[model samples]
Target: MNLADIPLRPGGAELLPVRGVRARQAFDNRDWVAVEIPVALEFNGIAHAVMLATPTDLADFALGFALSEGILLARGELYGIEEEYGPEGITLKLEVASAAFARLKERRRSMAGRTGCGLCGTESLAHVSRALPALPPGPSLSKSAVARGMRELASLQVLQKVTGAVHAAAWCTAEGEALLVREDVGRHNALDKLVGALAKSTLAASTGFIAVTSRASFEMVQKTVAAGVPLLAAVSASTSMATAVAQETGLTLAGFVRGDDLVIYTHPGRLNGQPATA
Candidate 1:
């Protein structure tokens, strides 16, 4: 399915008129702010987790959350999604395969909705991390390709450009064409939305890399590897745990990517223009 064809709510952002005062000077103006609402994800009529999101691309959010959270093994495991709105917030009811529901029941963790927290509902520390398979070898990206992709991703962040309060994730071809981009108030949610969109399409994950506008975290790396994408590049620094996980999972991790420069934290061989060491 083309991500552009997906139906989304119009509440991603709102413009509010406000008065600004600077050095005894006052002016009235309007400011665009990203909208965040409590979105509940229910699997098979069972409430699983709730998150604060921009309330757009929700179907993508639901599918991405399922994959990143390990609730569903594959896209086929999700049967359908229905949206319900109420005074309180929106609810996404997901119908999944019976086997997936059983697995969800086995590992019960309810997330408390927040923009910055990804591992909020863990019952134990052991559940914080999941076993991830090593990603298959992906196409090597050139320095020019990485630089171009970052520039394109920055331009594609329409929501961020408007509100300046949202993060974005983009999937780009090795030659720097952006295939899909998703934006949300939360960095993790943005990546999840992108992953879900990729999974639903016929795009080959091994042919490209995922780029983000936020700092890379362990959960971000986990989501990328879960989607079988071999490379993840971030515009900011990555966490220690994220770097470690990327190394263990054989996923190439790059950070601080801007204008032809990037720091390869793990699996540097995936990038073409790296200096050979003795």
Candidate 2:
């Protein structure tokens, strides 16, 4: 799809004209800015949560949210999705299986108004951290592949290139080819869109890892682990909590992926080759 041809409102970003002052000089310019809005998600006619996100690729956002949030067990459980626009915000009404709907209600009864933080609505410490199965063994990626993937990630961020305020998440093969990429104002939202896009496709995720143009936070590691992606590469640093989670879940986490150098926080064996230097 040609993103340039798409309208801004539905495309999740907007370009606004503004006045700029630089070095005591004033001029007029137009800036591409990311659009953040309230998105209400409803499952089986019951309101679930409201998130602040970019309003594009909402279908993918809906499905990815459901899966990463553990509301639905499988993609098959999400029967339908209906979008409604109003003066307030956009609402995504999703039709899910009865079993899943029941689980959602039970889960919601314990907490309300979950934010996009990915852990905001948890009622207890146990709920804050979800138990994930050990990641299945996957093909090792070479340092060259990781370097290539980092280089490719910059060009793939079409939205970020325009807005200069968005994050991107991409799925790349072991050979460093980026197959799909999603962008959003929120890092978690970008990852969710990528996961949803991957889930809707017939691709085998086990053959690849994920790359993000943002710092590796705990929620980032959580979502990657939940999606069963073994390795995650970030353009910046990883938080201490994020590294701990990555270690416990057996997810290979790498940060500071600039040019040919990257720091592997866990599972260094998955990255094959001598570490590149500055």
Candidate 3:
């Protein structure tokens, strides 16, 4: 299926343009609409969780979800992912070997149907702020690279361009060259897709900086660290908790990365030049 053909805002009302005075003109009025879809993710024979996603990158979504949730150690452990489409919705059947299943059982202790929510089964503030392993130190990215990466990220977001309703995450090297890009309605999902693509390409994520078109949330920092990427650049602001996580994980977090200016939240040493005193 054409990526462009997929609805930008899934489950939203059809966009019918009003005819204008110009004979060949075509445009639709901007409107905000909620997107909801049934995405049932089944593990082995047990139904794990059903979510509502924009349904563009279900494979990436499945793989990323498995990795982020600690359901699988690596991509190799996942045998296969099959999407079963029916009248009800899309059911993602993820097949894994017994070893991975065993590991998942140990990692995830709860089974109370906290299905659709991204941060599922977390009962307390402590769980909400789980620890992430420290990121290995990587090469510092140039100022120009950071700026170019953010601009390239915007161009790669086809869904967001059409609907203005999605976020994008991209990776680039220290020399202003973008490598991979992923888009999703949720910022975390976009990062996950980028990570999954990075894994698939067998690229050394350590050599590049991860750029996101969303606010730097704690999970965003956590996911970047989990991918072993040391640098994260976001187009929007970062929460205080997110900065703390970045600092703890030894990841360089840059926020408000628009055209020319950016705010370095932590690890300013990753910038090409010397740290700027604010």
The candidate that wins on lDDT is: 1
Mind giving the per-residue lDDT tens digits that candidate 1 earns over 82-191? 99987667899999999999999988996786899888878889898999887766566786787788899999989899998999999999888888999999998999
Extract clashing residue pairs from model 1: none
Off by over 4 Å in 1: 1-9, 22-25, 273-278
Give the per-residue Cα lDDT of candidate 3 at 35.
Answer: 40
Specify the poorest-scoring 10-residue window by lDDT in model 3: 109-118
Winning candidate number (TM-score)? 1
Residue 144, candidate 1: C-alpha displacement in angstroms? 1.7
Each model's C-alpha lDDT? 0.87, 0.82, 0.74
Off by over 4 Å in 3: 1-36, 109-121, 124-126, 273-278
- Whole-model lDDT, model 3: 0.74
TM-score per candidate: 0.93, 0.90, 0.81
Q: What lDDT does candidate 2 reach at residue 208?
A: 80
Which 10 consecutive positions of candidate 1 have the poorest summed lDDT? Answer: 1-10
The lDDT, on a scale of 0 to 1, for candidate 2 is 0.82
The model with the greater TM-score, 1 or 2, is 1
Q: In model 2, which regions exceed 4 Å deviation? A: 1-8, 109-116, 273-278
Local accuracy of candidate 3 as per-residue lDDT tens digits, 197-266: 8877867888888999888888888888878788899989998988888888888999999888999889
Candidate 1 has a TM-score of 0.93
